[model samples]
Target: MDEELYLIKDAGVSPRQVRLARVIVGLLVLSAVIATPLATTPLLPIPGYMSAFGIAMIVVNIILASLLFAKGLIESKESSIRLGAAYFFVTVIFVPLIAAFPGGLMEAPIIGSNSSAVWLWCSWHTGFGLLIIRYATSSDDTAGTATSVRKSILATIAVVALLTLGATLGLPYLPEVFRNGRNFFDDSTILVPALVFGVNAIGLLCVMRMREEKPERLWVMVGMVAACIDVWLTLYGGARFSLGWYFAKITSLFTSLVVLISQLYGITRLYHGIAGANKILMTQANQDGLTALSNRRCFDQVLEIEWNRARRDKRSLALLMIDVDHFKKYNDCYGHLAGDDCLRQIAQQLLRVINRPGDVAARYGGEEFVVILPNTDAAGARLVAERLLLNLSAASIPHADNQPLGQVTLSIGVSATVPGPGASTSALALAADKALYEAKESGRNKVCTAPRELVTPAPPAFLMS
Candidate 1:
C-alpha cells in the first residue's frame, strides 16, 4: 500500500509544485476535519450534546479548510512546496498547544488566553495573503512607474485593516450575544489577541512594502501568507468553535517551517540564474565571431574612450593600417573561401605581433586591418610596423599564384600624432591611409612611414632662371 501510494505521488510531478502541494494540503485538512472528531468524540468522556456539537464543529472545519485551501491553491502565487511546508509547520505548533491546554481554550462567552493566540494566528495569515497577492502581480522589472508602488502600498494597507477588523469584531463579542446577561467583551479574551494580530499585521505589511523590488520578494510573500493563515485560524477557533480552534493551531505550526525552507531554496535559484546570465552577456560582447580576438566594433569603442583620456593627459597615440598585398587577386584565383582563411591567418599574426595592454589589432574592413598603439610615437610606431611586416613575411600562409607556395606579405603604414583640440580621429585615419598608399606604391610588401615635414618644392630650375 505504501509503495503504491508513493508511485501515485511520484507520477504527478510538474513545473508548478505549489499547485500540487495545495491539492495535497487541502485533502489533509479535509481528512482531519472529518475523521478526527468522529473517532475522538466516542473515545472522550464528554456529554452526548457536547459530542454531537463537537462533530458539527468538525464538519464546519472541513468546510472552512476546504474553502480556504481551494482559494489559496487557485489564487496563491507562492510555490507549492512553500505552501505545503507552511501548512505542516502550523499544524505541528497548534497540535501541541491544543493537546496541552484543552481547558485553556477560549470559552464561548469571553476573551482569554486562547483568544490572544487566535488573534495572533489570524493576523499572521491575513498578512500572508496580502503578500501572495502582491508577489503574483509584481513584475521582475522594478524601474516601472510610481503608480505600481502606490497601488501595492494601498493594497497592503487594506489587507492590514481587514485583519484588524476580523480580530476585533468577530472573535470576542459575537459569542457574548448568545449568552444572556454576560458581558463577553469585558472578559478581555479577544482583546489581547486582537491587539497582537493588529500590531503584527501592520508590521508585516510595512516590511513587505519596504522590500526592494526583486525576485527575493517571493520568499517574503510566503512568510506573510503563513503568518496570515496562523492569525485567521486562531481568531476563528477562539470563538469556542471546536474545528476552527483545531485547524487554527495545526495550520500555524505547519506553515511556518515550510515557508522558511521554501525561501532558502528560492533565493539560491534566483542568484545562480542571474549570475550565469550576466557572465554570458559579458563574454558575448567582448569576443570576436571569426578570429576569436577583439573585433572591430570593440576596438573602435575602446580606442575612442582611451583616446579621450590620453588627450586629457597629453599622451602620444599612434595608429597602424595594414593591408594584405594582392589579396583581391588571391581571392579571385582561389575563391573567397580561401581568402577568408588567409585573413584568419593574418589576424592571428597580428595578435602575435601586437602584445601590449593598450595596443589592439582589429579587422577594419575586407582584406585591411588597423592597430591602435597608445603612448607610442612615430619612431615606436615605425618599429612596430616593421616588426609586423617581418612577422607576416615569416608566417607564410598558402598562396599559389606567388613565387613561394606558402608565403604571404603585408604593406603596413604608421601614423602618429600628439592629440590636441584640432587633431581629429578622421585626420589621423587619413594620414595613415596616405602612408599605406605610399607603401603599396613603393613596392608590393614593405613598411612606410608618413613624412613628418611638409616640404614645398623649390621652383623648377628653368623657372628660377
Candidate 2:
C-alpha cells in the first residue's frame, strides 16, 4: 500500500481540506440528482408549460462545472482531472446558450462556435480527447506541474470570460439545439451526440489500457460511462422535460460519486496491506525457519535484556549451550531434509520443558541452541538439562551410527554467574561455549559446567554427567 494516496500525505492535502472538498462534491452530486427530476417530472400536478427543468439544469450544471474545475486544479497531474475541467467549461460556458437558443443565429464580431448543439458536441469530445492524452502521459515534476495548472486555470477563466463577453455583446454565432416540445433527432442532434459518446468511449478504453492500478482507474472509467449515458439520453430521450433528461441528471451525480468511493477504498486497502506486510517481516526477522525457535538475533536481544536484569538484582544467571551429538554424522546418514525435521523435534521438546517465565530458548547457530535461565543457579540449570535429555530420549528419534548410548542425544554446557561491575555477556557466552566443548571431549551426550576457576583450557575437563 502506498502512503501517497492512502493518508493523503504524499499528495499534501490536509484532512480538513479533503473533508471540505468532499462536502462540496457531495452537495454538487446531490443537487444534480434532485434538481432536474424535481423541476421536470410529469407526475407532479404542475402545468407542463411551467416546467423549470431548464433553469434547474443551468444552475446545477454551473455548480458541477465549478467542482470539476476545482478538482482538476488541485490534482493538476492527472489527465482525468483535465477531463473534469473540460466538463466544467462545456456546462457553464456552452450548455446555457445552446439550451436557451439552439436555432438563434449570430452575425457579428466573434462567431458563436457553440451556438449549435452539434458544435457543442464537437467541443465536448475535444475536451475528452485532451483528457486521454493527459492520462497516457505522466505529468511533469509536481512543483512544475502545479505552476502549469495555475496558468491553465487563469487561461480557462479568460477563455470563459471571452465567451461570456461575446455572447453578451451579441457576436456572430450559430443558433443552439434541443428544446422542450422539440424533436430530439431533428437536424443533426442524433448524429452529433452519438459521435460525442463514441469519442468518450475511445478515450475511456485508452485510459484503462495505460493504467494497471485498479483503484485509481475505476472512477474515471465510471465517469466515462456516465458521460456516455448522458449523451445517449440527449439524443434519443424525448425532450427537456422527459424522464430521460432526469436520468441524465442522475448519471451526472454518478460521475462525481465514483471518484469519491474509489479513492477512499484504495486508501483502506493500502493501510491493511502495509500492516500485514509488517507482521510477516517481523516474524521472518526474529524466528528461525527450520526449528521455529527464536533465531540468533532474538537470542542475542533476550540475553542482553536478561543479563542487565541479573546485574541489577544482584542475582545469578545461567546459560545452557546445547549441541546435538555428532550432528554432522546425523545429517550425512539421514540426509539434510531429515536433519531439519530432527532439529524441529528437538526444539519443540526444549520449548515444552523450559516453560519458565525467565527462560528463553533459541537456535544460536547450526546444530547449536541456547537457553537463558535468569535468576537460576547451577543446580537448577543441571536439572533443566537433565530433563531435556530425558524428554528427547523419550521421543526416541533415531541416530544408530555413533555415540556411547545414542539414539540422537544432546551435550549441554552450563555456565552460571553473579554479575559484577566488570562482567560482560560475551565473557559468559565464551565460558558456556568452552564448557560445551569439554562435555563433547569427555564423552558425547553428557552435561558439563564451567568451573569456578577461569583457568581456560577446560580446567581439567570441568564436571560431567
Candidate 3:
C-alpha cells in the first residue's frame, strides 16, 4: 500500500482492479444494447441540454488534462504528456462543436451553417481518435527533463489550437455532411460518421493492445470503448433528437468522468506514499545502523540546538563522552559481529540511564558515544554515567582480552557549563573529549572530570593499544 503507484507508469493492474474494469465495461455494453433498439426513435429535445452537456464535458476533460500534465512532469514520462494533450484537444474542440449545434448557442447556429455542426462533429471525433492513438503508442521511458516536458506540452497546445481553428473555418467550405434537417442514414454525408467510427475503432484497438503493458490504461481503454459506442449511436440515430443521439451524449459524459475519477484517486494515494517514504528516510538518516542510537550527525545537530537554548535560559548543560575499554581487542578476539552486538548493548544501557526527555545519547564514532543532558550540572551527568557503567557490568559480557575483572567496561568523561554571552559550544565538546582521554590514561574502568579552565591538553596514546 505504501508503494508509490502513481509514479509507476507501467505498474500492472491488480486482479481486483481488473474485475472492476470488467464491471464498468459490462454496464457500458448493456447501455449500448438498450440504446440500439431506440436508435431511430425521435425524442423531444430539451432546451439547453446540449449546452449543459458541452459545458460538463469541457470541465471534466480540462481537469483531467491538467492532472495528467502534472503527473507527466512529476514522473518525467512522455506518455502521460501525450495523453494529457489528447484530452486537451477534445476539450478545445467541444467549444466549437457546442456552438455549431443548431439553435443551441443563439437560436441560430453560432459559428457556421446548419450543416457545419455535422462537419465539426466529424472533425472533433476524428482528431480525438488520432490523438488517442498517439498517446497509446507513446513510449514509457523517461522522455526528458521537466523543462522539456513543459515545452512539449506547450507545443502540443499550440498545435491543437491551430487544428481547431483550421477545422472550424475550413471544414464549413467542404461538401455538406447532411442537409439542414435530413436523416444522416438517408444522405451521402453518412460517410463522415462511418469514417469517424473506423478511426475510433482503431483508437480502441491501440489502447486495448496497451492494457498489459500499462495496467492503468484499463481506464483509458474503457473510455475509448465508450467513445466508439457513442459515435455508433450517433450514426445509427441518423437525425437530431433521436433516442440514440441523447444516449450518445450521456455516454460521452460517462467516458470523461470515469478517467477523471481514476486520476484523482491515484494522486491522493501518491501523496500518502511520498509522505510515508519521507518519514522512513528521515529515521534512517538520523539513526545509527548498528546501535540503533542517534548517530554522530544527529548528535552534532542536537548539541548546537541545545547549546543555543541553554544560552538563552542561562541553564547548566552537561555532556558525557564514553568510550568502551579495549573494544578493538574485543573485536580482535571475538570477531566484528560481537563488537557490534556489544555496542548495541551499551547503547541500550545508555538509553535506560538517560530517562529524561531532554537527554540525548548518540554514537559519536567507533567505540565512542556521547550524551547531552539539558539543565543538568556536572554531578547529575556523572551519576548518569556511573549508572550506565553499572548496567553494562551487570550484563557480564565476557571480554577475555580485557585484563583482570575481565568483562566489557567503559571510560567516561563528564563536562558541565552554563553558557555565557559569545561562548562557543565546541569548548564543551573539547572539554569532554579531554576528560575522556584522561579517564583512559588513568585506568580503563573510571570517570574523569574536566577542569573549569577548558584548555587544550596533551594527546593520550592508549587508543592504539
Best by TM-score: 3
In terms of TM-score, how similar is model 3 to the real structure? 0.82
Ranking of all candidate structures by their TM-score, best first:
3, 2, 1
lDDT of 1 by residue, 1-465 (tens): 334333323322244654645564566456455544432121222334333433333343333333323433443423232223223323322322232222433323133233433343434444444344443444334333334333433554455455445544555543332123311133444664565456546635654674353323433444444454445444433344445444544444444434444434444554555566656566567656666666677777877876786688888788888898888778878898888888888888888878898788877777888889999888998988888777777776766665443467788888877677556666667778889999989875777877643111234588778
lDDT of 3: 0.82
TM-scores for all candidates: the values are 0.52, 0.56, 0.82
Tens digits of per-residue lDDT for model 3, 1-465: 235434433355668778988999999999899889889899998999889888999999999888887878777888888888778877877887788787677778787666667766777788788888988887878573567556755775676566556555776456655555477644565666778999999999999887454445988888988999999999898788899999999888887788888788766666677777777778889999999999989999999999889889989899999999999999999999999998999999989998889899999999999999999988888998888888889998999989887899999999988887435678899999999999999987888888856823333567446
Give stretches of model 2 more than 4 Å off: 1-37, 40-216, 224-254, 309-316, 356-358, 418-420, 451-465
Better-scoring candidate (lDDT), 1 or 3 = 3
What C-alpha lDDT do the candidate models reach, one value each? 0.55, 0.64, 0.82
- Best candidate, lDDT: 3
> Number of clashing pairs, model 3?
0
Q: What's the TM for model 1? A: 0.52
